[model samples]
Target: MTDQSAAPDATPRPLDHLAAMGAPDALALVDRAGALSFTGLDRAVGALARALDGRGLAKGARVASWLAKTRLASLLPLACARAELVHVPINPLLKRGQVAHILQDSGASLLIAGAGRSGTLEAGDRPADCALLIEDEAGAASLAAQDGLPASAADPDALAAILYTSGSTGRPKGVMLSHANLWLGAVSVAHYLRLTADDRTLAVLPFSFDYGQNQLLSSWAAGACVYPLDYLTARDVIRAVDKHEITTLAGVPPLWVQLAEADWPEATAGRLRRITNSGGRLPVPLVHRLRQLFPAADLYSMYGLTEAFRSTYLDPALIDTHPDSIGGAIPFAEVMLVRPDGGLAATGEPGELVHAGPLVAQGYWQDAERTALRFRPAPVFSKYGGMAVWSGDTAVMDADGLLRFVGRDDEMIKTSGNRVSPTEVEEAAVATGAAAEAVAIGVPDDRLGEAILLVVRGDPAGEGALRDGLKRDLPNFMQPREIRWRADLPRNANGKVDRAGLKAELTS
Candidate 1:
């Protein structure tokens, strides 16, 4: 792995990642509107930045987008950075309530959505001060545009984006990211992955995800092309790879499984130079199958959290000998395993994973209590000392200093590449009056890393209503795989429902 070292005095903003890129006429982005060259990409970002600044919002205003993966949607991150605004991209799969919480929590001054999406918001869902614009009507049209702003530079540490992620409990919290964090992250990944201008990355993941956002950022940093696709099925992704001659692909374990199940032309599969997995572990058997299918492609197994952006990625060469290991720290990150008392863990001993470095996020937005809990002072042994993300995940470092994930210490359920909050799901169910008492737990599944199994003490006759309500209110990933009703739920000594007891019983 390349050791990342960024000098103290010089730091770049997010937009600087794309500045001075090679070959202005080379392809940079491809979407429904058609392909955009490096020149076109710069013009698009400049035009969008101009339009956003003309809205009369303050320089540090929060701008959110809830549109699907379109040309404009794909370019908003860069545009927002150029305008000195914090961009918040919401997952299109999120329901109206989820979108509302993000806007209100981030205090977004403007939101851009499609015309049909505006009516989806119910009363009180939108903040009073927030302005809405139909993206199609906003019309980012121009081939010759330049940044008219003065040569004044932006602060690298200024907040650039607020990415909302479902915590272990309560509502989803926003993770604050600075310009340097993003620019360095892009540099780190692009350097390690050896991306080049000839590579074409097929961006299939949602922009809200940190890993997904990098698909655009890293490619731009390497002066490569990114083809964003909003695929409805696994077949759509397979066809796109052949059609676009995609060379780089990133996915979670669940998505990798879905793509594996679909039939692929050998020639098309060979076109992929590298594929990556994060969010969840890939079973050893599946890893073998992927290697067999894509003989020419390298497979990267990674582990990350939103607070730190990324932690470790196992090199492709180690997949056969150490398929279970999460490898060592990525560039610009310091990964350490700490004991219960905050001391360093001995080799082969399990401890909490702590990440410290420039890649670490600023913290939770406007919520100091939660931020203080997760983002604490770095371990005494850390080389990059400051604030570090104390990830509540248990892991062990091998003698070679490689980390192998043991288990999660938190109760968050990871399903289909999405982190789900158990409490949030239960609260929504109770609000629908489907249950008086509820306990949400994650059950082991073959496909999804963890499938939600909701147990409630309510009328069995309300099953139909509960299902319908959840379908309407929750995202597809957050929906429970099965609903079971009981007369009583076990309680711990504190008098709260025992989610641990339910998970143990169900999984056993």
Candidate 2:
């Protein structure tokens, strides 16, 4: 295993670093609609931050966003960081109920949403005390015409954002990240990825996700352009890459599968210099296919969590021989394998993957019980006494220090790059009143990599109604792709649903 050490002088915030680059005229963000230069982006963010401050929301108060990957969403975090308010980005695909839970849980005072998405917030039944700000209006000249408010002085250790992770309970837990945590994560990723001023990145994932948000931070920190696209087809990605001459593209395994299947022009493929995979591991066949398609790009296979932002990444050079390995720790962080007995595991031994160092988040917001369970004291031989994220993911480190993912220690299902809780789906299914008992399992899917499969013991007559009920209760990604009628779900000796056995039934 690699020796654990600290990085020297990791002090610069992402926005401050970018502002100091002195390339204000360079492209910063682009979409199918248009582009924003660095100068334009800075002015817009400044105006929005000032506007948010003028609303009298206290510093460190959570400002939630329910929007797509628009320029406003791209710039919200930076503005929040400057104003010393925590930005809570709600996934645009999330249902109103889920959005309401996040808003209430975070106690967000100001909510910024798109003009069309206002109905979602209204339907969520949030408290009347919360103020609503439209993204379109905030970006317009009228809001900018108001007086500029001074930026709030914030400590680096203060909370910046609360990202909710899918949990076994019906409710999601917020992963608390500080300014220093996010800033260092951006620096580490940018340094290891070799992002540069001339590079342009394509962003397909939502900013609500940790890995997805880093695409904006790291690229901008390097003074590079980030093109955010909401793609509907593989052809859309190809067109975006060619149209923008994108040098970097980050995606999950499902996206890689689609891209590998879609025919790409030789000229378009040659322009992409880096391809990053996270959210889930890419199969060997898909990895080889991607290598063949983008011969000029370096492929990086990464593994991480919302709590730590990132853990390990397999180097592009090792793809040929160790395609499945989730390599060693990136710069500014330390990853360790802790055995069940609460001791360090030897090489080749399976254990819980432990992440320690600067990138570690503050903990779960307002959920002390869960936070205390996951975030604990660092094991012996650590320089700092801060909390280390005990990722409930089984892994093993090779003698050469490369980490390989085994499986989840918890019963969480990662489908379509979103971490979903089977219990959450089952609860929603049972709540529909059609199912006497329900079990949700992730079955392998060609398009999503993993799709939710619901096994229900219910009236066959109500199956259609139950499906419709789930649609209203869950996000598009959380909804089951298929529903199977069963007399009863398989159970273990403890009487709980045997998710593994259920998954096997579908796959076998």
Candidate 3:
């Protein structure tokens, strides 16, 4: 066990992260609009902060942004923190129901969104008190505003952002991140990845993702410029990389597969200095193909949960030799494999991957019941000596102290580099009135990593209604690849849906 809290919490506030790096004239950000220098980005952040502060929001009030990867969306995270508010970034891909849930659960006082998305919300979709602001130049604060606030001197452990992610059997929970968590995580990833000012990162993932948000924060920490892209196709990514001369790229497994098979000019493929993977494990064959295609770039395979931000990451040097490992503990993180007896697992023994340290998130927002179930005091053997995130993920540490991916303790379905709750899908399926009983199952798919197979105990004719209803209620990723209709469904001893039995039958 490493000394998790050996150093006191001296981490800088997230807003100050901007002021410390990047010279005034150096390039800082690139978007569809144009490039902005470090000085220009700093001023924009300050102006946005001043505008948000001018609003009559109380300190620590929840300020949510549900727009695309626009300039306002990009600047809101740090801007909210500087104004002593918590930012809740809703995934733009989510529909109205999911958006409404977040607004109600987070008690968001204000929502800034584009008309395209804001129009999707009807009647009760928005909370009674949640005010709305347009996302354009006149709607919210514009980039050309003035009176930017200086770097903040706020508490390092105060809430900075609330990132909502799905759990195994419940509605999406908002993972509360503090300034220290975000700062230390950025510094750790930048140091391990050896980021530098000259590096250019093409951020293709959503800012709502923990790892995705880190791309911006970590790049800023290293004084590197960031190019944020919201792409609809793989070719868009290729074009962006070529246009921006990007050095860093981060994606999940499903995307890696697409890129590996993508036709890239030799020069374009070699431009990447580093590629990082999260969201899911990469197949060995996929890893080999990536190595063959981008031999010059370092590949990092990382594993993390929202509760802790991140845990283990494979060293680029060991990728070929030990391709399956999730590596060991990251900086400021002490990852331990604890057996059922609350004792540390011996080498080669399966145990839950428990992460202890400052990088741990504060916990889910306003859900004390679930919070206690996930966040608890560290084991008596812990050196961190505080609450640790019991990941509920099983893994085995090799004698070399390297950890390998095992399985999740729950039936959470991971598809397209995002975690999906089977319960949410089942609930939506039944809500369509297409099924008397519904069971959402995740089956292995070479393309999607895992394809959703929704089984329903309803009329075969109801399949159309089921698919259409799910389309409205759930995101595309949550839609079932196949809907299996049955006259009757299996049941457990307690007479509830036997999910284990269904999964067993399908896999068997």
Candidate 4:
């Protein structure tokens, strides 16, 4: 782990602090059309912040944005942070019910939505007191015409944003993040990544995601430019990289898979200095292929969740020998493996990963019971009764202290009374040329209580041979009872495997 003292104190407020960046004329944001310099972005954010405040909304009130990756949506977070209001970004793809749920849950006094998305809010019955601001010509003219208002001074502990999780099990829960929490997270990531003012980051992930949002904040903190690309195809990514001279890009495994197969321009790829992966681990084969493609860029395999933002990251240098390892605790965090009995696990022992330090979130919004279950005190040490996120992820540490992810605790399949990691099954399946991707689930069985079922995407003709090969790799009990091949596995909006959807398919 890097020494904390060596880390730079890069925390700054979203509004005024960022405006003071040394090179204000440097590009800060880039869209398909053009780029916004630091000075230009600050002016726009200030105008928006004033416009939001002039509408009679008080400090600490919620302001929701339901739009695509437009310049306004990109600026709203910082603008809201400046006004001391919590910004809630609704996923544009969400249905009316989901959008309404977020609006109600956040208690947003006002909503700033694009014309298309505004209908979702307008059609739904909302609180009578709530005001709506449509992001249209009229709204833009209104904002442009409005006079400036004083910036709201915010404490570091004030609520900055309320990001909603996917809520695969139930209703999405809002994750409360303070300015301090976000600032610290950004600083931690920036310090470890060694971000600089010359860096240009291509933003592909949704701003609603914690990891995605950090790409903007950390880059801004380092006075770097962020090109927000709402790409329709892999070609869009390839084009944007070359067009903007992009240096950094963050993506999930699915995006990486797509990019790896896409016809990438050598000139465009040559400009990228860094590429990051999270949401899920990049398959070892895919990681190697990416390394081969972008020989000049540093490939970062990171592991994180909304609850803690980011936990571990495998350095680019170690990708060859430890492709499976998720690496160690990032700057400002201490990650440990705790056994089921609440003791620290020995080296190479699998246990729940407990993340301690300032990076832990306040808790799940309005769900104290669930919050208590996950966030608890640090068992190994306590300086200020600090809370640790008891991540449901199972991990093992090697002698050198690098952590390898085993599986999610809830995702562990029990077959014949033995716990098995679905990821292990999936990894083995993907290793064979027969499958491009795989997911394993334990289905109900009269004899064994549960039986393993495999869902795969591959050539149908080779699936039979792949099943035989899987049996050879796995034990008799661990071998899947059923093998179903699909053209492609179902993915959620964030591009993660929709296990719930997969399970539904099995029952249907």
- Which is the leading candidate under lDDT? 3
| Model 1 alpha-carbon miss at residue 17, Å | 4.1
lDDT of 4 by residue, 421-440 (tens): 67767876886778889898
Candidate 2 structure quality by residue, lDDT tens digits, 1-508: 0112434347845342343332778888887547778876676667767866767888789999888887678878888877678999998888777788888889989777877877755644676777777767444543462444334456778888999888865688899998888878877887778888889999999899999899988887777889998889999999999998999999998888889999999999999999999998888888889999999999999999989888888889998889989999887788888887888899999988888988999998988999889999998856654789888899998888888999887778888889998888998899899899998887777668688888898778889889999988888888888888977778999998887787787889
Tell me the tens digit of each residue's lDDT in model 3 across 1-508. 0122343234656655563478788888888778888888878888888888888789999999997888777788788888889999999999898899999999999999998999999999889899998777677534345787778877988999899999888789999999889888887787778888899999999999999999988888778899999998889999998988999999999999899889988899899999999898999999999999898899998999989987878899999998989998877898998999999999999999898898999999999988999999998898897999998999998888899989988899999999999988998899899899888878998878789999999899878788999999888999999989999999889998899989989978
lDDT of 1 by residue, 345-379 (tens): 99999999999999999999999999999999999
Once fitted onto the true fold, the runs of candidate 4 whose alpha carbons sit more than 4 angstroms away are 1-6, 10-16, 121-125, 145-152, 382-385, 411-508
Model 1 weakest lDDT span, ten residues long:
1-10
Q: What is the C-alpha lDDT of each candidate?
A: 0.86, 0.82, 0.87, 0.77
Name the better of 2 and 4 by TM-score: 2
Best by TM-score: 3
- Give the clash total for candidate 2: 0
Every model's TM-score: 0.96, 0.93, 0.97, 0.79
lDDT for 278 in candidate 3 is: 88
Candidate 4's error at 10, in angstroms? 6.7
Which residue segments of model 3 deviate by more than 4 Å?
1-10, 140-144
RMSD of 1: 2.5
After best superposition, candidate 1 residue 475: deviation in angstroms?
A: 0.7
Regions more than 4 Å wrong, model 1 = 1-11, 16-19, 138-152
> Model 1: which residue pairs collide?
none
Q: Note the residue pairs that clash in candidate 4.
A: none
